[model samples]
Target: MSEVPTTRPARGRPRDPGIDARVLPAAVAELAEKGVSGFSTRAVAARAGVDRRGVHARWATSEDLVVDALATLTANLRPPLTGTLRGDLDDLVPDVARALSGQRRRVLQRCLDEVGDAPAITERFRRDHVDRCTAVLEDAFHRAAGRGELVAATTPARATEVLMGSLLLRALTVGDDAVRGDALDGVVDHVVALVSTSAPGARS
Candidate 1:
């Protein structure tokens, strides 16, 4: 009689739990230097010092890979809330500003430059980045409104755009180093003032 062969195949080595910690940042670095058009798994593999299989095994599409990479950069933009809207904004707003500089700024610039040609990337940006920001702001703003810290009319969309855009503007216009920590104080103060002085008639 012939011996029966085992039906189940041998399992491969267990995946490195820290592969994301390595690949995502490398993907962002590739995007910063090459933009979307030039972005490639091979380049990222070389930069990350891992086989292309490691990256591809994790992310099936470039869009998927890039969005996850961008997520890592944007992940820390949110700060812990202090209940009071002003205190929350004090930390949250500055955190957003600080993140908009340096290599992260380059990543954003590359995304903006090439995203128009890539609808998949555009949708990913909205789903992963824009929508996340809006959701967080909506929670913060509505909570503040419930407590009478912000006007009931406060619109998270316009406010999110304004606050986030202002911080991003500095990095785009004057480079990352130009975004001063002190200047962010003014942004928070002005927004708080808008709620106070114009709360009744505020559009957002």
Candidate 2:
């Protein structure tokens, strides 16, 4: 007798690409509004206008969804390149300041708070947010070097650290008002001055 062939049943409707687009933004909005403690798959599904099953199908848990959503948001933010290092760095300051404050800040704090429970989420956040930011600055520095605008001793990582650290401090300690005011301008000016001073053939 010939062997019989078997076929498995389909696992429900095909996944919708548009659902992902809607769900990611909805997840971010939910986290911004409700925080980790209040965030739920049901709420995200409702917000996205997708079936709860769709959300669960894509993500195993609310934490997973949150991590993915935050990653999506961070990945979309690229530092502007204005053909000059100072111009590019200046262009990035306001956005960096904005990210460190407001709803984004609260969402970040909540992520930190939940790190013990979701270490993977923390790692993903670091890779998605911190690493990407560093990469952008590093690229800018390399471009400056290629243009002979940066000194041999200038370190992209160190410069990124200094600029980001200062902005974070201002955002977390002095508040967003400082970030939005002349303080931000002062910080950008200081970084630019430091870079200019350290550049090749700069006046001491």
What is the per-residue lDDT of model 1 for residues 1-204, given as tens digits with 9 covering 90 to 100? 998887967586656778888888889999899888888988898888887887788899888888888887673556457877777777676557666778888888888888777778879777878678657755666667767665555455565666666667777888865565667677666676666324455553
RMSD values for the candidates in order, in angstroms, are 3.5, 4.3
Q: How many pairs collide in each candidate, listed in order? A: 0, 0
Candidate 2 C-alpha error for residue 185, in Å: 2.3
Collision count of model 2: 0
Clashing residue pairs found in predicted model 1 = none
- Relative to the true structure, candidate 2 reaches a TM of 0.75
Weakest ten-residue segment in model 1 by summed lDDT: 195-204
lDDT of 2 by residue, 7-118 (tens): 7768889888888899998998888777667788898898889999988889988778987888754524476778888888777767767777776777777766777876
